[model samples]
Target: MAPKPTSSIRSFASSDRFLAEIATDARRPGYVLAGDESFLYQRCRAGVLAELAPPDQRDFCLHDLDLAEVPIFDVLDRAQTPSLMVPFQVLFVRGLKTLYGRGQKKEEFAAIDAYFRRPNPSALIIFVADHLSIPTDLRRMDMQDKERFERIRETLGDWCGIVELSRVDEGDAARWLAAEAVTRNTQIHPDAARELVDALGADMMLIASEFEKLALYAQGKQLFLIPPQHDQAQPVADIPTPTITLGDVETMVLAAKQRSLYELTDAISAKDRPRALALLHGLLNASDGGEDSAIGHLYMLARTFRQMLIILEKNVRDSRAIWSVLWHGFRMPPFAAEDLIRQARRYKSRADLTRALRLIARADLEIRSSPPDKRLVLERLILALASEPKPAASGSFHQFAIDL
Candidate 1:
């Protein structure tokens, strides 16, 4: 009915407008810049401070905070910095949740609560969290994400307005491509632009940056013409004469898919089935052409499984978390810790994995064992592995559960 808000606000204070208001308030310089991601916080701080700060501190205070390690209190408290004569100081407590992860002796929440009470007025205290889940207690905040806009309105009880990023549909993508073409002085074929948007999805930053790059490469080639090197003539006298061609897009797509596939293989070897599956899916979709070579695909899959067997055999004895596979064996995607736990449970024991490996081995052999039918063999192997359940590894295994 009204408008959708981009991020959730656990309280009115979490709203960006209120954050700006905090900067505007000469009376109240101290405020918490807490939000899901530090990106918004950093941007907000920089913009507001640029308006208010004197020339020097403006640049220094905006981004210098070491959010990953600074103890919340050490920054939040009205403590002295190396220099004091400075007119005003802003305390940016970046990545506030990382504090909770420190070991026993370093626990500092009690001190943090105390620091929150008397923050420095001269300094605007801003805390940024990339996601609510970053905080040990913040995950619960997501339930409020759906009702985020309304909740902010209610929570702020009178806080601030959010400059939200709009969610776009297919049609919107088209409109954006046309309007953007004129702005950057580059002509984008509707199809090429749409393809780029869909592949990139809805990340605003990605869309903006990529568009600019496209404009740069597309410069002078307004009609999306083939380059001079190709020796292709203009299809239409009216077509603006593009310096770049769809061929360039095709090449990039192939390169991305190849890298993504190899990455998938690495994930599989780590016994990180979930990451492995995600990488496979990404590779499948990232390319314009699907599965360039069936024999090549089969080879990759077989190698992945073979590597997995080696890691599993050693890990069965070491019994370390599955993640150690990344460091000890081939590296996979940047999988999260929770994914490792979930993927681990699916491998009931080394035997189940061994069985899966055999199917893949046979598939690989089938491909080279004869003339081909390689595509069918590879697909069959994927299905065989896909059929097996990969429950989240609860780290619940006893006596090397290898039924094989």
Candidate 2:
């Protein structure tokens, strides 16, 4: 049997692992860095460039091209050329969609696909998608684009490794913040890290930038970087600094900014009326988009409750099983998978979630219809969602089974 096309693609969650793979493997000629998330892709590209050439040699060894501006033939020419100052020439191509996106340049793509078969070993050719050309949900991509996406995937699947550099989820983002803090010679309390992640919502670039600012804040307060003690047990005598408290995180990272609407979703799931109200108020008052923001919250809440309804109706118990199904079907944040399962129990039947969806749809319509007091309408909806425990006149749904 012919090998499965996906078998050759490698996905990496850790920046360390991805960088290490490219650094250690000198023979891998090309990589397709897919996904719309630019921050992760940039980091991976930076690692490859750093490995391929030093700053001084980059002028001579690195070639950057955007398919939108330059032709594929030009890109191929650059990739084929060897570096004069370094062992490897780095060829970076951005906007892979220009080639594969609608208005198919069959001849150009055919040439590029052929090159992937035997790319120049002396140059690292990387094709990157800076933003979602095709839908992040591949199923949402039109049949034409989906076929184009699959063709590209299969063509480069064996010849070049495919790296999906997408955003990390809430849990992974929190863990990354903590790990990054350690690297910066600082410490973040678990709660503080979680707060940062919740407020930021997995924008890795923003999270990293905030960490730099936090490091300075800690240093200025003299709360980080304890003095070395020669008498300490180990030869390395530097003492650990104090942990960054949640308060510090709130003051530094959040700075009274409106929390993400995701918190409101959690609040509604947990049925915390007061918290949900407060979050809704903050989102309405502080969020920039006003009515648009309100609609976004409704959409998110509706979508989340709908997913929970599925889990409840199916009575999916094991976390692994739930995640496996959700991973392929819906894109829930991995960190919140367990939370969703737990919250599913609050629903007595599918009717509750279905009613909630109706309420959200109603709210969306009201906002669009130009209500005199839009916030008032949303607040009332929140109260109703908080107060209602189960759907009225509902069909039977399997009870959520809690493991002992």
C-alpha lDDT values of all predictions? 0.48, 0.68
Clash list (residue pairs), candidate 2: none
Backbone clashes under 3 angstroms, per model: 18, 0
Residue runs of model 2 more than 4 Å from their true location after superposition: 1-17, 133-149, 223-240, 260-404
Candidate 1, overall lDDT? 0.48
Worst 10 residues of 2 by lDDT: 1-10
lDDT for model 2, please. Answer: 0.68
Q: How well does candidate 2 match the true structure in TM-score terms? A: 0.56
**After aligning candidate 1 to the native by TM-score, how far in Å is the CA of 85 from where it should be?**
5.3
Residue 195, model 2: Cα distance from true site in angstroms: 0.6
In the range 1-404, model 1's lDDT, one tens digit per residue, is: 11112233322223445444544553343333434433344445555565556666655544346547665555644434433556666655555446534564233645544543554545555444333422223433445443443433343222213333223334455566566566555666766765565555433345556666666766634534544554455354545634334444444433223445555544653556667666655544443323345555655555555545555565533233444554633533222223334343445566766666667666666756663454455545555565544443468553222121
